[model samples]
Target: MRTKETVPEEALFAHHQAAMEISVFGKSMDVLHKEDFLRNEEFCILVKLRYLLDNGIEEYAGINESIQLLKASIEAKDSFVIIDQTESRFRGGKQQQFYQFVEGLLTDFVSTEDFQDRLSQQLRETLTQIKTQEGQVALRNYTEQLQKLAERPLALKLLSLFKSYNLADYSLLRQISELVQQLSKKDVRDYQSLKPLIVANYRTFESLGKIISLPPQRSNPDTFMRMTQVLVLEYKYQLPFVQLANLLMVIKRWYQPYQNIIAVREQYPPHRYEQPPDFQTSIPGEAIFLKYKTWLTEKSTGVLFLDLGN
Candidate 1:
């Protein structure tokens, strides 16, 4: 809970105490290996130091002096705990290498931990917004949040996470797909160009379903949206069609005919209609008619269908 920017000095001192207590004995000095002991010390020290630096303790003097003090604290023997195979004559040559390694460790202690801390903070922040006690409801709420904000890039990123993880459910997939479609609205050309992203999100869901033994209901729109978002990210940015087909198959099987009728009607031109009033009574039957209708319409726009009559 102690963020780099907001951690109190007192709390960090407490963490120092806690890290010190991690040894078998309740003190930092009890550790037998000087380097290993310092390594443990370094964890808390680095965290607090970074916290201080983030909060305007910009003086390099204090931190640099602390580093020196830490280095001096290491026993000479512990600094050169090299393998027995090393020749005694080469000890002097190894000292320089040891110094370089220590310096690199110090630098790494500062930069890598700091980066990880920041990344953890960002992840927690984003996850907090999306996660909910209601589980499925929470996912739906998060998907709706992205939709409302029109945050296509963030949504895409989340979608990738969901899909690669196979977090797709019926509700989740529908919501994620809808969000992608929403992003494609006239104002957001960048989002329109993200069709591959949209497709990829769906594909991740499919892959996840195959690998992980999640409940089939996880593919519901709410669950699928979150899962697909995760999945889209997992496939190294490639969208898989097999998953998309599976998802479409699920949707086709489960979706109400009325809803499909509405979608088909919207796809058809206002002046044109399909042949035979009851042509779409069965699921596969409807799919075939719709596919043929789509192909013919593409070939001749509305003219071919209109000329044929209902």
Candidate 2:
């Protein structure tokens, strides 16, 4: 969304909807753009968020994982939730006893006889994707053998929780990454505080692809990428899909009077979109979500949807 040259704040910004159109449906040099699919808002927010991320990357280097650790410590059950327009809950945890509504994903993945083999294969797969250049070297020095990965009592617990995706994967990966950084001098037990990586199954893994392709208004791109990356593997494993990612919130309060700049189009009369109440953002959700314990139950319901708690 960066312009070829810098654009000053006083400059007018025009997009598909706000800009002029020379309509000639599906013809050369004709402008017949579908309004629904246009991503001006996406591009705008992506650019803004990128600015925020670029400026604040250091603070959030481990934000996703860090938050999960805090969440899991207080909560006894799996910590997971799905963010969508419909607010659908993904089923996980004690199904069977967690719930008899459907088969229990946790019981099945953890109780299988060939779980060790599965863990070995999954470890190999996860290793290749590690962004760290020295991750493989660290694994080699730390893990003498791949077959015995899950044999470690903690490793077994970690892998079992990994299938569900939520609190486990981030905590496990971060702890493992930290362990590797420690040159394997510290064992996984040192980070046992990260027990029970909470997994929240929002509806089902089947909806993940749909969510990835057409994300909700507040979906985070990083979360989408992670889910998409996992979908490739889940096709075979069908493991419970849980995600630990961020959300987006655009907050523009009425700090100052609405500007007088107006946008004019040939099709419509001169109109202004740079005013309040008609803007892309609405009332801030962070305070509203966190304050209302009645709306958001204590530990059972998470109160973070505005990108690391607003």
Candidate 3:
């Protein structure tokens, strides 16, 4: 239905507007895409229609006429009403529950264990393909481990949820990636928050083992990488002042040679190495240098600075 016959111009515009609103609100696209509000249905539709009208892409048409036309179509018995199960509620009057009929079909289809078996098999095959050398070793190893764990009945039963709920999509992968990245960066302070993501990632790896051998990654995981680096820094630098001072000293010494190297750029810039004029005199320079040195000393702990030999 999402990509069948071309949606009417009005409906397509409405979908775009609604999609933007839902995304901004951080609501589920699935829910907002198929909602059927009873009281303000026309009003909500007109809001989207109005946006299209003012945008000058399409001829501006007043929604009052459209509503009347729809009402007339219903009176003539030419239009049909389609209710989605997830969003609409029927009072169950003389009207047959349109929502229930669809839900019934879905429930029957999803309840079958046969489809689950096929899906699991498909997943396993997909997972094998991901294990190629082009993929990350950590992800490959994780998938392999999952495959072994799923051999157990209990593990298989629990993992059936991925097949049962049918959440194996880009969305699920995105969520899993987020959870994993968060877990990787977190200090594991409480340990409880860390456990769920760990367990879920393990289970997801097992389920993905059936279909995808390669590990999933963010479209751009640079942020995740930087965050993980900070986590590494924190873990490495969690020490007393004495040790941290020694660490800083080692880093400063390592950078000293490069820092001292002069660039052979056409000419040397004036005052490149001299202290500021305000600190040129012995007394003033001594005072300013002490202040600057103290500030640098305070800032240097647990930090690594690099000189490009310029």
Runs off by more than 4 Å, candidate 1 = 1-171, 177-181, 187-194, 204-303, 307-310
Deviation of model 3 at 246, angstroms: 28
Q: What is the TM-score of each candidate against the true structure?
A: 0.15, 0.18, 0.18
lDDT of each: 0.33, 0.29, 0.32
Error (Å) of candidate 2 at residue 163 is 13
Error of 2 at 242 (Å): 21
List candidate 3 segments past 4 Å from native: 1-171, 174-193, 206-310
**RMSDs, each prediction?**
33.7, 22.1, 30.1
Error of 2 at 291 (Å): 21
* Candidate 2 residue-wise lDDT, 1-310, digit = tens: 4323332334333323222221111121112122221223322222323333434443233233322322232121122111110012322232112122111322445543365454445446555655554544443332333234334333333333443443322333333233223422322221222222212222222233221222243234444333222222222222211110111121211111111122222222225223323233222232332332222222554432223221
* Model 3 Cα lDDT, one tens digit per residue, 1-310: 1322332455334434433432332222122222122133222333333234334222333222222222222221111111212112323321133223322333343333543454345435544544344332423343333344333433333233333544334343444445534544545333244444445455543443323222233212332232223232333233432343343343333332212221211122233432223122222122322332343332535321221122
Best by lDDT: 1
**How many angstroms is residue 22 displaced in model 3 relative to the true structure, after the best TM-score fit?**
47
